[model samples]
Target: MSTSWRDRFEKNFISPEKKLGLDEILEEAHDAYLGWLAASLTAFHSDFNEDQVDQLDRIFQGESRIRSIANDCYNYAINGRFRLAKDAQEQEQMNDDWVCLAILVQSARPGIEEFSLTVRGRPIGVPAKLEQLLFHAQIRALLDFSTVDGFDEESVSVPQFFSQPVPGYLTLKEIALLGQMSERAVRNAAQPAAADRLQTRKEQTQTVVDATEALRWLKGRRGFIATRAD
Candidate 1:
């Protein structure tokens, strides 16, 4: 008779005969979760060569919540409070869970950032003026929020351009220099939150602006466009 998961837990996972240290298992799982993100990004962005992929993966490892959760799960599993390895297949099941959660994070990142700016934009700290600039009604006309999920509409090779961010955008610091204001002032003014998420991570919230669009935006703010329209 083959041993069951519950049986294996009784025999080895909690016993002195365990095959691997809990800490080692946790580290391995954490690496695998971040590695999954690297793999997905590589598929999404051809311009993100191996070196760039590796660099981003390292950054995510440092910042992501996924790794932290996995570490916690492993520690709990080893203490006999819960049983994950009653059988040979249980470890693989835990890995699948990690992978699924990582993908969910990758998929939802764009939407989350957009929502953050629209709702909780304060903590991220946009210059107060720029904040209003970003959230102005006309801003959506200048900033695009959609993503390409597939090429079913395409009849040829996918446009490599999709792998990168749309051009004509600048960071807050750049905008500050162009506006001849202190960066702090720019952040203080940066408000209203725009949709700034990306499927390929081309830009982050409060980190991108369109100088030309901003000029147009400022005109409206100053009543030039309003006056012209009136």
Candidate 2:
């Protein structure tokens, strides 16, 4: 029996190659990551209805597989490898990271976390904690978004929806859209400039909290003492 085109592709392109040395492994991982990112973004776009795709295409300036690859690359580089953990404990930790990222993304908008969590099958409990962790990931995502100088502004800010700290799960875009008069209005008003403002507000809030915590920790140090009232 002969192999079909699909079977040939499965055997050649989809199957994991033999493990290599550390450098080679990283190179291979990077290549694989790029391929996976492209596929995933294509899948995401394909999942949208024609109207939705048309709206996004206008806002984003066109279909952008490169932007998708860049996003995935940034994620992999900052978060390290995406390999499943070796044991149940490690797997749980991985799950925790995913949940946290989902929460952060959801918080920025609203529906994003739920959408990502539902799609990813993350648990509902301890969502707040997960969002905190995702805040860190969102920071990394932000930095990466900033690095791609030529990417469309609207596309760049779209990821900010994942950087917020909101209650429960929601996808980034969904949360952002909830504030609009209606879903159609949101789609019509989609602009990178607006998204940037929302992201800036969230980051500023996080900075204040971090500074406050630092001050509190300094006050609690062994040698620190509060000034007495005159």
Indicate which candidate wins on TM-score.
1
lDDT of 1 by residue, 32-103 (tens): 444444445545663234566457767754435554544433333222122223333654554454444434
Best by lDDT: 1
User: Model 1 Cα RMSD, Å?
Assistant: 24.3
TM-score of 2: 0.20
Q: Rate the local accuracy (lDDT) of all candidates.
A: 0.35, 0.31
Candidate 1 wrongly placed segments (more than 4 Å):
1-18, 54-64, 82-230
lDDT score, residue 114, model 2? Answer: 26
Instruction: For residue 61, give model 1's deviation from the true position in Å.
Output: 7.1
- The superposed Cα distance between candidate 2 and the true structure at residue 2, in angstroms, equals 55
Error of 1 at 164 (Å): 41
